[model samples]
Target: MKKFLFLLVMSFSLMLILAGCSGSSEDSQAGGDEANSEGSTEIEFWTMQLKPTFTDYIEGVIADFEEENPNITVKWVDVPWGDMEKKILSAVSSETAPDVANLNPQFASQLAELDALVNMDEAVPAEEKEQFFEGIWKSNSFDGKTFGVPWYLSSQVSMYNNNILEEAGLTGEDVPTKYADVLDFSKKIKEETGQYAFFPSIDGSHLLETMVTMGVELTNEDMTKATFNTAEGKESFQFFVDMYENELIPREVLTEGHGKAVDMYQAGQLAVLSSGPQFLNTVNENAPDIYEATEIAPIITGKTGLMNVAAMNLVVPKQSDKQDAAVKFSLFITNAENQVEFDKIVPILPSIETALEDPYFNELPESPSPEEEARIISAEQLKNSEVLIPPMKNYSDLQKAMTDALQAAMLGEMSIDEALADAEQKWNKALQ
Candidate 1:
């Protein structure tokens, strides 16, 4: 009987051990399943200078995105406008780059050339590409492969100081419509007001865009050779040389960029400021008197009757493990509805055609504000504007060569022909 009791106790102990093992196995499996469901994939997104001002909106976007895509999360970082290039390059080298980033086409092209970006043509469907403006879409491509998705855009607008124009005996009706008319207007405004009429920044990309619009073909059909050394090119360039020599434009144009141009305009030293519509607010904030004197017009054009288009785009790093998630969120942010929402926050125009169709973009205010007029005219111009500077692998080199030639000519270091010829030579070499 004692032996029987001992066997019973031993069997009970064995049963307890077996129960504990079974419970441990079940708990381990359940824990793993929970982790799999809850471990959301995280992606890093970076934007240039869209912070503080756009914090709430972007945070809301991230939150909404997370709710809809419970398996994905976005971590947002805002970099200053000036540091974007260096920061991104460093991150890419260290293998710690953001999964996606905001960039201009020029910078994005450089990365695309280095094979650091994903080719959107292969990753994005054609229908999705159709969502953005055609010119914007084409601008974001590098060597036939798109590397970025276009986001917001701005078409240049003519901002005139009404007081200055009136002092120069010019009415709003006298606004320049063509490149030649711009020269004529500049001469009159300078003669009457003794203030510079226009200061087209030689350091900016505007000159190249204007030259293209004026029919100075920069390259051959395949873009393998430089072709901008012809009579049309020389004539196109001579216009600026004459403006500089005659003092119709600012003397500092060779060194001054867009910022200086805006400062000059706000200080009542300029009769006309050719810039994006958003600059109206700068004038309004910094020089309210001048803002009251400011009037908007469709940007002056050349032979093609089209203005240059500028756009900011979103790009995905090729090395990202979250490429799919990044692309998906990028599409979400740039979709028509979201882009329109963004436009309301800033004075920018959306690159999406359907976004431009929003009533906010379409309905001009009864008593139109400068912004209202600027947006309408700017949007209308986009229908005709081609991407003036299509993707060129040697874009930076070409820009430098052109600017160098312009400076040399303006400073009288070289004649118009000599300057353009030198630029042509440099361009041909770069293309090769």
Candidate 2:
């Protein structure tokens, strides 16, 4: 059942990706596309909301490339968030795949099975990968083959509302740095102010930020299975259950997506939220008045320490006709300038370690206070993190099973044990 739901979401997301291309005007041209190079070599491109966002930067980079080469023209396509994965899969299978497609490690495993990715390890030397955060380099690898470069990457950052924290008499000093700390704080907020302290999502591995802090890896060292259903996994899920039974967290959080968390924080109903750096833009747009009140920080510590999501991935498909050009463009897009621009909205750590260390980590946005600024960059607080889903044939399916177990636990239809047992059975079947 979990597998079915995830496939449906992917199917829907893919359709949305293709639908974006259909809606794109012949010229959504940020800048005019230069005429195809003199030799008429054309490289097709597909991206998810990269322009005016990162696409504008991409155009500048590509235009520069075109001027220098004069032999390559890029046919770029915009993919909407909806149905994006389906369109990507379809394009790769139909012999119309992009030379470079914006992909994440989530898709890396599945596509590796579908024969849709290019293994370009030779192009991206090991030394080059040293610049990225430790786990990020391994995120895009499949069966020991490097299929993608690090584009922009960010850990799951801690976000909070200064106004509410103050109301609860909590200040920077009260900030939690561990998974247990966050759970405790959430309870405090609820007790003192009737607002949520922190909401760790069951929908996905955003909860990973906490589990990682507890020294739990989502997958085992061998990567043969989803080890998250183990003793540590239950303990992690139980943290949320304790919060729920205690009324420390709002029940809406069970059904709420990340957007809701952002909205709640923006509205001042939530004292704490966890998301990527992209929350900066959402704060700026939806609740401008409260923008200043917004703060970012690293995840609170558990017994072990701070933890969060690893990063997103940049990838090449097996059918790309212009491997060399794709590599060039991939490198350019992930460079420091582009990383900064992309982070303005996406706010994840760039894969480029130099980019992150650029004294920028110390800088906060035009937020409410120094405390708010500190909270968002809290991704750097990572003492430990988990990112070990092998590019197996059935990751998306496994993720669904886990998500379902969580949801069921949240809904109280069954205990965490019962749901996980059922999920483990389903997962073993999928493995076969």
Candidate 3:
């Protein structure tokens, strides 16, 4: 592939500029400059391989984008979750930087500082910017310049086993939305079912779903220090302690990865899950029976109502010359129709207007029951469920601290209060 692009560069050099009258000797130098310029015009695209779990939906979307704009060919590469950030950072610092790639929507600030990412305000049509979720789009903006376009929105929803809930004389519809209710219910389920009520597999940031739903903002309004020791933050972390002590969540979740949670859920040993849509699809494929029997609902709220969200952004690299094509592809993928199709497979919020009207989303087909109303009820509620954090510069390291703290709490390695304070101290030190 590199040779093909290089050969095209060689061909262009021998034709136009080399044929011009320069100092004649300076033409060789011109040829090298022209070659570099030529290849930059070729569109290079990268995806984080996140959507592959749902299906080959991303491939179809990319194909449609290529068909509409035939002038540029997109080279798509998938970086796995384990090594995505490290690999992308190294690749961008080298000659292999892509014309466009996926990154954490909030990650733009650091990369922008390195001059590796483009400010989208100059690349995109301003009027079209309103198509995305406001807070999500704001994550990709820094210093008044847009750097990424919101691709999709992910909310942490609660999934429960209807059979288990029914066995305990309850249903999700009858379940409470308040944190206190959940704590009380967890105790009740432990008394009745013997099996744990929830399995919060030591996923750190992923657990933010429960916290955000509880009105606990980890960062203050000024974006400095760790306010996680505050009233709500304390309440949020205490959830782990209460659930664990009440024997609602198993001790193994402290160390087990996501696979463990899936295993238990498939076995019908776990009644409730604080999970994203990815698990819903995983259950569909791996344990089709469980998928059929399971039910989903908006995450139960805190004393004060709130919910946590996850999302992605697509951006054009500043060094690419095919940015015109990159910009077109960005807007194309985010159009309402495309987003809806993409979200149908992924089961997340499509980051565009007029997408929720689709029949597949409004009402989906299910077996042995009335048509399954999609778990998402009111669009406005989903919009309001989002929790916005500032551009976290040391997020990678800070997230590690939070993860360790969560795992410790999940395992009872440390008391929840102690873990939160240790994490807060570790995080604050980095900020300084």
**Highest lDDT model number:** 1
lDDT of 2 at 345: 47
Q: Which prediction has more favorable lDDT, 1 or 2?
A: 1
lDDT of 1 by residue, 307-409 (tens): 7888889998766766778888999888898888888888788888887777887789788888888888887888887578877756777888999998899
| Residue range 99-133, candidate 2, lDDT tens digits | 77777776656665443565656666567667666
State the TM-score for model 2.
0.81
Q: Is candidate 1 or candidate 2 better by TM-score?
A: 1
Residue runs of model 1 more than 4 Å from their true location after superposition: 1-39
Model 2 bad stretches (over 4 Å): 1-40, 304-306, 341-346, 363-392, 410-412
Which pairs of residues have clashing backbones in candidate 3?
A: 213-306
The whole-model lDDT of each prediction reads 0.81, 0.64, 0.66
Model 3 agreement with the true structure over 1-432: per-residue lDDT tens digits: 122443344354333222221222243233421224345334667777665674376677777876776545666778776566656555554435566787776555666544456577666777887766667667677656777887877766667888888888888785555777777777777788877777765464555556665777677655567777777777777777777766677878667766788788888888876666667767777877877778766666775676656668888765454556777888887899888777655557876656766765566454522113334543434656654454665665676787788768766798878888998998888666
Q: Give each model's clash number.
A: 0, 36, 1
